[model samples]
Target: MKKLSMIAAMLSLLVSTGSQAMGPFEVYEQALRNDPVFLGALKERDAGQENRAIGRAGLLPRISYNYNQGRNDSKATYLNERGNLHEDRHYTSSGSTLMLQQPLIDYEAYANYRKGVAQALFADETFRGKSQELLVRVLTYYTQALFAQDQIEIAQASKKAYEEQFQQNEQLFRQGEGTRTDILEAESRFELATAEEIEARNEQDAALRELGALIGVPSVAVSELAPLAQAFQSFPLEPANFDTWHALALANNPILASQRQALEVARYEVERNRAGHLPKLNAYASVRKSESDSGNTYNQRYDTNTIGLEVNVPLFAGGGVSASVRQASANLEQAEYELDGKTRETLIELRRQFSACLSGVSKLRAYQKALNSAEALVVSTKQSILGGERVNLDALNAEQQLYSTRRDLAQARYDYLMAWTKLHYYAGTLRETDLARVDEAFVRR
Candidate 1:
């Protein structure tokens, strides 16, 4: 009863504290702005959006201009009716040519444009997947820190209880009312609890460091979890059956969607390479102007404009086109295999999380019952010690059991919450709204 009152008082103090605490969703928001991995994905998506423009360029008209200006000196020898005539000329010559070409028929360019569309889609889906991953990662760190904090609390409580027992046992022994074995046992347990408290504090520091790295901070204090009764209220909205989750994953998983786009890209690559066997056709126009030529025509100026159609039929390219086609086909095969493997792996992961969530609920209930039983045992053992039916060592062990049960209950709570989040992540349904829902389970400060 006294421990319960103490816990209630601590909760009240936390609720009334003025200092702010970071919630998981807030951490996620910070990570969105600061996480290098997610920022890189955003850049990659922006880069992918240019693929359409790059591929379409092959189908567009192209224009080029060339100009040259130089002084030329030449001497020419001519033999006509006379024996020989020598001519010398020096002139400044300048010329410019402008040309334009438009593709009349280009199967490879068409395939490339389609491939670009697929690539852009792939990038979008990849970014979406990264976004979900960041949310999952932030929450994971938050839960780890929470669990570590719980461990520290449990260790401290156990240490304090053992210290009190040791002092009482030492005084009793000094007064010839307690055995030396009881005093030694109490002292030993107290030292072990102190060591455990130190280790728990270290684990908490490491967990906080990990969370800080994600959000680009040196350290952070996370908000306490909402009361268990309140946190559990969110679970009823989860899907009931495994089939529903599996279907959702198949339909919506961003990774799988990205891989499908990759497969389309590989298919178009094969088409682009295969089109190399086909003839190419282009329409071209050119304007040319020249001021001077060699010695004979040194004083002449001319301008010309022309339009024409060009055709190139591939006879052979030393088997380069065929090799490229073969390579693209091999790549397409690899993409197919990868998508198949990823689908299976995704389903497997989904199943694992689904199972964990279900089992976690049951485990939470079991641990809660165990905690109640352990608390009762502690009270009973202490009462028995007063009546001389139980020794001091039994009371110490009961206290340890109660603290251990508290730790287990705390861990189960975190595990249940994390498993629920993970299940949604694997289903590709995690979103900021999901984070909002998770935020309901945490105090703001």
Candidate 2:
């Protein structure tokens, strides 16, 4: 009973320890929330929002207060028989006023605000694009780490088989049933397997370290990834016509969206420049107060109030306004051309990703069949050897073939998963929810 209890305790400890290890999707989630690049993109989006606010402010009313106080030494003048006389005197004057200006009809302000709105939308899309890009990178590294782990397992298994063969050959040589050449061959194979195992282990370790750094947890240990399973079964493979994909790419791609916004901004810039040739009108009002000690006046204090309208007509500006309008128009044209180019490029990429996804799925199916055949062959060879058939190099060759097939199958599965992810991402359908599903698949239960 005590032995059983100890075994149970050990099993429980292993489970507890293994639960601490994170999987690929969990790592991606943690990186999304903590990674520096994502955080920087978020900050940039916020800055763009602030810029929108600043632009909007241009169309709003502005109010200001002004105050002035001064003391002056002067002479009083009287319109009399002697014309004017100077007298030693000093006077203090003070005034305060309030002014308000509203953009009653500013075309430039309207265009600028419109541009700001477009820019803000573009920034939001850019942030989303950054998030998608980060997720792709995380998936790539995670799959690479899994591939390395599989390679290590394969190498270790091969090494163990070679070691067993070596021991068997040693026993046969002792009995004078096997030649020294067989023993030496087994030893050489065993040494090669050991070297391969070491190389595989080192590669896995490096991959782990790289993933850890990417996820902002440099100490994390990635134990294992979930077997690629039914998650990829429902991936759509219908080859979308070029026109259909082109339309989707134009509408959904972040780069295309950003270019479209840039074009809008450039168009608005032209409008803003053109508005510079229009007249600007404003209204102003002020009140003033003064005090004198040596003037023939009814009171020592006086006040004045005035109100008026002002107009500024842009008659000429050394052709600067025309040059600005021309430059803005040129930029607008360039932006339009860029938008077209980006749309075409994105459509091409979508087609390429779609093709890759289809090919990967096909490859996965073929590899799955190959893996079954390899396993069968390994079992058959083992049975033949056990049935008194002399185990020759054919047995070793069959084992090696089985190992290669299994590794290739694993690689095919990962490739299919990656290709599926790429398809969804390009389709703009890879969302946080999809990531959450991936997380659920990898979670230790």
Candidate 3:
């Protein structure tokens, strides 16, 4: 009763003083702005944003200029018209033309533009998925730290109790009222408790460091969670029909949606390759001025302007176009199979996590009952020892059992929360707002 009262008082002080403790959502918000892993994905998403512009550029106008310069020399000899004549010609020749062309119809570029749109959407969805995943990771590490803190407290409490018992046994033995075996047994248990306390402190430190790394900060202090009783009193909502979760996974999962976009890109690839067999046409205009000296005649200078349409008809390629088409077709087929595979895999994961959450409530309930029983046994054993009907070992065992149940209960709650997060992820509905829902379960402290 005294230990329980002390724990309650400590909890009250912790709640009152830990106003600045970082909760899961608080850490998640920091990660959104600063976490290197998720920030890297944002940069990648930015890079991918240019896909549409690049695809659309192929359909825009292009303008260019060309220049040429040279010297010409010739010698001629004839026997009939005029007695053998010989001539030589040399001159600097240079000309420049500015040309402009516009593509009127480009099926390949059109298909590629559509593909670019899909790819951009895929990037956005991928980033959203990464953000949601970070939330769960933050929550997981936060809970672990809380559990570690509880373990340290339990270990310390047990160690204190054992030290008192050992001192009492030693005094009684010194007075010749206690057996030597009783003193030795009490001292051994005390040593074991000391070791346990050391281990629990180490675990607590490690958990704090892990949590700090997760939120991009050094380990300092974190807010204690709401009382476990309050946080886990109610079970999570369960799916009415398992098939409903499977359907939701297929339709809403962000990864699966990204894969669907990839499939769209592959289908467009087929269209782009098939376009190679179609005619290509461009309208062009240019103007140029040039001067040249012909050895057989006189020097001449002229300026000219021209405008025309250029057309290219693919009569044949050494089967290269056909090969490209086949490759694209194969890729499209591969993407289809990949999407199908992901759908099944996603459904399986959804069911697994869903089932865990469903059964976790029952497990939590059982542990709650077990903890009550353990506490009662600890109390009864102490009473029996006072009446000379039980040994110190019996009370120690009951105390240890109670602490074990507390740790298991804490772990089960963490698992329940994890499943809740995963179910939302598979359903493509996880978001920052969802973190608020989780926060409601944990009172600010």
Candidate 4:
């Protein structure tokens, strides 16, 4: 079993590099087939969907048939006036019956039908929430991998700059134009950069592993994202009202809606239990054919037919019915509390994501400016080095700063996208169509 589990895990990590490029939505479609958690929810949804039919069956007529074939033997002893007589007989006997019963007035069954509808609705909402959650999860994993890849690039660029600085310092020292201290500092910096490069590469690999696990692939490479300005400018977030978003969340959030259904079903349970004490009426019909033996030693066959209405009036039940009603009522109260809790949580999350999304635009702009300033600083430092106003080390530092700022800028863009998606998810407005614009934001690598 352990080996099989390992194999499954390994298969989930297998990568198909030859396939066409896959984005967040494309990967999610793959996860729908391979993600175990989502698959389990799908099965549960299908099973819950059967509740309506199951409940309907209870309100329909039930028909049954029975047949029997066997041999029967009999022995008899009798004492008369002055003599005793014994007789033995054996025969084959067969019987068959067919019956149908229909409930005329069953309050509990009616309540059950209502409960089934509510339960199925609850399952629907739950399943929808799971589906929306899949998009968020896939996007998160995909972006994280990209972010890790960026870090590695930054580290390698820094490493290269430091390597050049070290070589220059070493040559200057040999020519007596630089001090030994300069060479030592440059060498240390290069070594540190190398270490950073190794660490960053490892992080990138780990990130890819996580992305693979999510999409049931061993390895993956995400396409490069479009420049922030082009993407955001083309598709800007508008009508940023927190109250409006919160209202939408309250109205449509699947988790909260599912909880609402739960509460309704609980109310039905209380009704069903309360109705248990009410009288029940049913109509029944039956027909039977049997073989029998008479005292005269002759076999006979008979047919019987029965039809009647049955009325069951509850007189007393040792308080069991009342106790059941109380239990159901308590459960109903609990469901009400659960629904309230779900509503509160959904509102809180909606506010958080909405705030993030609303502010993300400005945040991206600020990060972009920061990256620009860093790049300008690197150019200015390089000119200063040429003029002997700054050393090679100063130019290298400026380059490192530029890359760091760029990475942060990229991170902010991704954060904004994530917040946007999560806000829609909270509002239960996320769909596959929402990804179309986002997909355009990725250029094929």
Candidate 5:
């Protein structure tokens, strides 16, 4: 229990310190340090960098030194003019060799080196795609948290309006001017609003926790969006056409670029496997020194040096090389198909987001007008009640419509902002500056 309290206090401090209201870019910076996915990409990039060195090693000079030592025991018997003679001897022998080999014309090694180059390129582009994905993820969660907060605000406002209406109806009943049925209806609406408010709060908490988990914060609260009137003025689409966005996605989208590299890697893989059936050539040099005893030439030392060119011709590999080449060609075909699929998918998403941006602008305008109309209806309904043209229920319904319209208006604004960001993201132009621009739409609440 004591341990739990300390954990709770630490989390509380995290929330309090986060009171400064983090924008998307701020959260992204934290994620860069703490998010495991992004960190793993960094590590993968580092590991990929070694491929170049490893591939070049096959073409470079290779040197090695080896030493050997051994002991020998011998016994011999000989017959002489006088009698039989016996002799026994024990001795040690030692030898050392230094060797060097350099590839002169190895096709397989050359192909392998090229394959490594392509693999490294693929890894680099893959990491870039992951970086862009991180940006998208950060913005996604930030906007979700903001939307949840908006829901909470709208729910609270509804609950307050209904509560006031209920209280007014109760007073009217006490004065014998309102019916018991009217009071009961008001009571029911107020209770429903209260429940909605509770649900909205739960949603906001869940959203905050999700965002917090992403950025290694606990119970984070996002900075609220600036009022729509002020923020909308800054939210115009750049280049403003689906064609330009399509061109940009084709030219710059990191995932597409990475897939292209992957295709290149596959092509190189086919070449690498095909080269296995080719002959190899290498140049070799070696120096050796040896000393031996307990032989006819005992107590003598020998030194030798050699240099030559070596060639190896493949006769049969039990059809392994041919099979490998076939498999690699199949893989290359698969990569091509995958790249085609990705290209189509990317273009489809680009079109979808672009359409959203175009529609979002008109939707925002329509919702704004609807919100204005709803507000006017509430006022007119109240005035009508005094003129016997409306009832207490009419005013209550008008207020509810006003609140719902207001919520829709807010949601439209969020959708507009997100669409604009996603457009840039799909076009591969999303950057820290773009996030900063998005941040301008937010202010400390």
Candidate 6:
């Protein structure tokens, strides 16, 4: 008896521990930390920074060295005063030269360096935007997991209710008080409830696995989500127009900033193309040595060194430089247009999110009322069943209705949470610090 009691106590404790383990927020945080997409963005941002440094270095002078060696043979004819033509012997010559050159004046290099710096800044903004996107994905999946859990609970409750009713009908039928049809009906309902419970349990498992995969912890366990009361203690609402949201989005959205930077880059590209039309000055130095030998004739050796500045004036290039400049200018215009289009789109998205949030608030209130009504109906149907009325089917139907209402309420609550997240994200207020606020509200002990 003592061993049996101890085993039973341990089992009960295990069940209790399983019921109140970690919450969804913790899981999502862990997942975010390990997300591959987020990590990739971080690496890409670092690479962009390095590329920017390379660009900045382009403003400095460039130097190069060169060497050459060759052998040459030639024959020449000479005419003397005596009118007798004499043939000059062929000779082979070898020469090598070393050269160093540096650009003294180049406009395009400077413009490209500046563009690289702007692109680096844009990369930083893109990283931040990726973080926000990951946050949304994690939160959405976490909420789905919680909803699956709620469904499991509802299924369990319905299964228990149906089982009890089946047992009672079986007893009544055995005593000749209930018809066999009544017993069969109760049995069928219980079986249906059992099947639903199994399916709900399977759905819960799949949701948990998906959540685990998303957060990069395939082995981690998920605890039930806390009740909605703890998740939404206070609703923060502010009156704001679409203009306000547009301003925030334009100011804080990484994609918009990147587009602006792209325009700057395109403008610089145009400048770079125009620089092709200007004179390029370079300083250069070269040293050369040569040796020549004619068969059985003579041997000669020579060395020469020269240093000077060379200026290249592009008199003409088949109009290529002009065409390149025009193309760059057109790209700059397109970049500007893209920036404007993105701004308008962000503003529209912000307005839509705000409207959805407002709608969710009202929907949650209606769902609350509907839940209460469903609960009252369940209670009344139960009483009728106990008072010897033919109310089994009605009671069962009421129980199902109550579960549906509760599920709807849960959905509304999740929608409100998601809408709030979207609104904050659009407002440029979604940050790590803001996540703590959400954690406090949505994560319970």
Worst 10 residues of 5 by lDDT: 222-231
List candidate 1 stretches off by more than 4 Å: 1-19, 175-184, 222-234, 293-297
Ranking by lDDT: 1, 5, 4, 3, 6, 2
Residue lDDT tens for model 3, 337-357: 999998888888888888877
Which ranges of candidate 4 are over 4 A from the true structure?
Answer: 1-20, 32-37, 76-87, 171-196, 210-216, 222-234, 293-300, 314-327, 382-397
Per-residue lDDT tens digits of candidate 6, residues 211-311? 65655544334454544453362366664566676677778877777788888888888998999899988888888776763333347777889999999
TM-score of each: 0.88, 0.77, 0.80, 0.83, 0.86, 0.75
Score residue 376 of candidate 1 by CA lDDT.
94
lDDT: which is higher, 1 or 5? Answer: 1
What lDDT is reached at residue 144 by model 6? 73
The 10-residue segment of model 6 with minimum total lDDT is 225-234
lDDT of 4 by residue, 1-445 (tens): 7466546645543442234355666666667766777888898899989888877887999999999977777877789988999888688877799999999999988999899989988889899999888888877777777776677777777778777878888888889887787777777877777787688677767766666666554655444222223345224554567777888888889999899999988999999888879999999999988886344433888889999999999989999999999999999999999888888888888888778876777787887788889989988997898788998768767877887787777787788788888888889898887775666676544
Q: How many clashes in each candidate?
A: 0, 0, 1, 3, 0, 1
Which scores better on TM-score, 1 or 6?
1
Clashes of 2: 0
Clashing pairs in 3: 21-223
CA lDDT, every model vs. true structure: 0.83, 0.71, 0.75, 0.77, 0.79, 0.72
Weakest 10 consecutive residues of candidate 4 by summed lDDT: 224-233
Cand. 2 Cα-lDDT? 0.71
* Candidate 2: regions farther than 4 A off: 1-25, 71-89, 162-215, 224-246, 283-309, 378-397, 440-445
Q: After superposition, how far is residue 135 of candidate 3 from its true place, in Å?
A: 1.5
Cα TM-score of candidate 5:
0.86
Which structure is stronger by lDDT: 3 or 4?
4
